[model samples]
Target: TKSLSSNFIKNIVVEDLASGKVKEIVTRFPPEPNGYLHIGHAKSICLNFELADEFKGRTNLRFDDTNPVKEDVEYVESIKQDVAWLGFEWDGLFFASDYFGEMYDRAVLLIRKGLAYVDDQTPDQIRETRGTLTSPGQDSPHRNRSVDENLDLFARMKAGEFSDGEKVLRAKIDMASPNVNLRDPIIYRVLHAHHHNTGDAWCIYPMYTYAHPLEDAIEGVTHSICTLEFEDQRPFYDWVVRECEMPATPRQYEFARLNLTNTVMSKRKLKLLVDENVVDGWDDPRMPTISGLRRKGYTPDSIRAFCREIGVTRSFGIVDERMLEHFIREDLKLKALRTMAVVQPLKVVITNYPEGQTEWLDAENNSENPDMGHRQIPFSREIYIEQDDFMDNPPPKYFRLFPGNEVRLKHAYFIKCEEVVKDADGNVIELRCTYDPETKSGSGFTGRKVKGTIHWVDASNAVPAKFRLYEPLITEEAEEEGQSFLDHINPNSLQVLDGFVEPAMKEANGGDKFQFFRHGYFNVDPKDSTSDAPVFNRIVSLKSSFEV
Candidate 1:
């Protein structure tokens, strides 16, 4: 119970109970069954389910399936999986289509009471009639239709008597209402597409505004929580519920939706990217989708931590994407095991060590987690180091490798750069380094320190692996507001390279996580990894001076 007190949703419920307005808290996460759930949806799921948990109440997973053209069972199943993966359980599952029959009957009742009418105007004509914010809307010719004629026409419209959009049932509200949404909004439209769950049970379907409130009422939901964009439509939502005389009246509350920086959260924009094959699919690791984040080695705890840290706010705000990366890196720091991987390999020959000779060197699995113990890595005469680790000419701040400069080879002996071998194009082809046998790591040698340390893998004994490096999906922070979101797509978001890893990594199956020494956290890609050749996706980089 104390845990619930920390979340703002619980605080709201406590006030509701203190005021004696509600005996139990009830909430619902209503997602349209149209697209794969993304990281943004995770925020709403945690809020609804966690609030219900705090008050010992129930939360329902409802699909607002009003539009059959864009809805699908595939999306519905993916949403359920994503919610469950986020560590939340729904007390019930429902659909707007379940109340379609009841919703249709309510429309007929409204028409009979002179509260609704059947409009024969085309979609374009209705749009032209509903004026802009500065102008008052004009009434449709069918607005003054008699109650008896309206009822008969609506019933016939549902009985396959009206072509799709040829006729629509609209509420007889004031056309001059400044709110715009309350101006005789359409309650039901004729659509012939087959419903995912309801099938071809009816040719008429209820609009989202008309069915959302009714769905909440039927489920006995006490509080209908939604993003702020729906605030304008709330009046219409409430009107339908009250006129229908539902057994219970559900209240509506609005909060700002999550707007993440450097990423687009709109499903429509994400769909465009998917259709255009900008990335891979909806679950590409570069995507903001929940499944994509999971595959990218993001823990549920990190995501939950991110949401809890931001909490619920009344005003809109953009959360810095770095905050999310910070939590992820923090969570994986002490957990992920450490290994040696050379992404951009360069030959480093330990000339002093015997040729064809190899010795086992002890390396801690995770420096932050000592209890994780240690693993033995092979140290041999020749190894592969990072290409950037060595430089033919050293600058003032370049502490890595240079001719006549010494650096420690991580977990092995300290080596001084004795010579630099070059190629025809003037690229440094190899580093001829001489090792100090007495200055090996853990040898307890006195005053044995190097300016820098670099990671390496024994070339002959190492395993060939694939390294996938990723960057921000968008190059610019906020590209022109009115332009297509894709205009800022980062051309070099992902760069795949053949890399060298320690022999111990050969035993890892797909999905294994590791922190490559001096590199970044990485995970065995669930796709395109096998026993002999592994593909590791860079999870996140280690905190360095660059981040500051």
Candidate 2:
């Protein structure tokens, strides 16, 4: 099989095919059901699933749910949904807990063969005796137990005869090996907590290192793909599979994990962001969770494109945030509808229009897609424009608004700022503008070319809405050295603006996407939105050209 590109993992797979070392590619995405999938997981998911699909193979969705202390059914369902949302399907869904019985039997096999023993040392004592990277470890007194004694003790441990953390079964590997993981690693331990999927049927659980390879073998997975952090553990993984005499051995390949700028991918840190109420919840628009991205108006195709562009590699680096925004902008340009919203509104009165009469103006739904068609927007004598679009005094290069300055009202007629009114605080309260009846947009407004054009909503037809703006969650690089991720928490990642929009916005249901003409990309929030009071979340700013 020829690889699509030069990624090291793909190269390895190609060679495997050419050598006839493997007949069909089999890959698995094994994630612990501890936290919701973030952007990093998207990369891994795409890599394994895409490769398998390309090679006419299949991918398995396996939950490494060995640690019941933090795993739950809620996370399991979330993982499944996220994977499916990413446009991938599992050949079969399996759990490490599902194979606990066979894993325990394998441990018993190793014990009866005098290849393993139960260690009673405390965790700290074991750690201290394990020695350092440059030193050799001393053997434990319990390491020399007879095969029958070890088998009896291990069986008794499984029958609920041992307390949690009191004893652990370890592989009788070389104690003086240079690699610490090869120095008699723990294969199983007594975790008395009830499993989420297996329930209280068993108290003894196998360690991750001992279970992962076995699961892959039993499923006939040809390749076990994971991040670079597990490169060293591959040896121990092979040892477990080969010694257990599994029917087949699956090779493990390593790639660099995705690290993005201005975000934290650590599960523990993300949990803090949720528990502290720093944001609304896990699905907060500012969060990096899959649900958060979905709520923020990000399309799955855009995320998939990002993963495809980033490619797979053993070399690691932090990807720029602007690249993500770039793909999102490219995706929404043709999909989200266009509308006029007055975020910081300033009153403007068209003195020439009829006082009591209102008319409907035609507006394009999406300029990029002609088939999307158009809608009628209300236009009246009184209107509201952006407060920052006007100036009380004239300034150079300011084309928006000023006394005697002419500008076109987007989709409407040309207007001139005739007068300005001030309040008691000496602040510009209103702008009195004069409109030209003959200069209506698309109605032969060709006598003069307006330097600037602005968006507005009819005062009588404006709908009240809640606008949410988001910034980066963290100010520092995600993979920076010696820097605490908490130190970079942006105090103002989210700011809510009580603003107004066109009356058509009032009919918008949750999950509808729209662009606030020259403002930014926004979506109707599925949470806390209704027909009367629409809540909009800013997906990304149009002005933010995040250059690397």
Q: Each prediction's TM-score against the native?
A: 0.95, 0.96
Leading candidate by TM-score:
2
lDDT of each: 0.86, 0.87
Quality of model 2 by C-alpha lDDT: 0.87
What TM value does model 1 have?
Answer: 0.95
Residue 187 error, candidate 2, Å: 1.1
Question: Which regions of candidate 1 fall more than 4 Å away from where they truly are?
Answer: 1-9, 477-482, 544-548
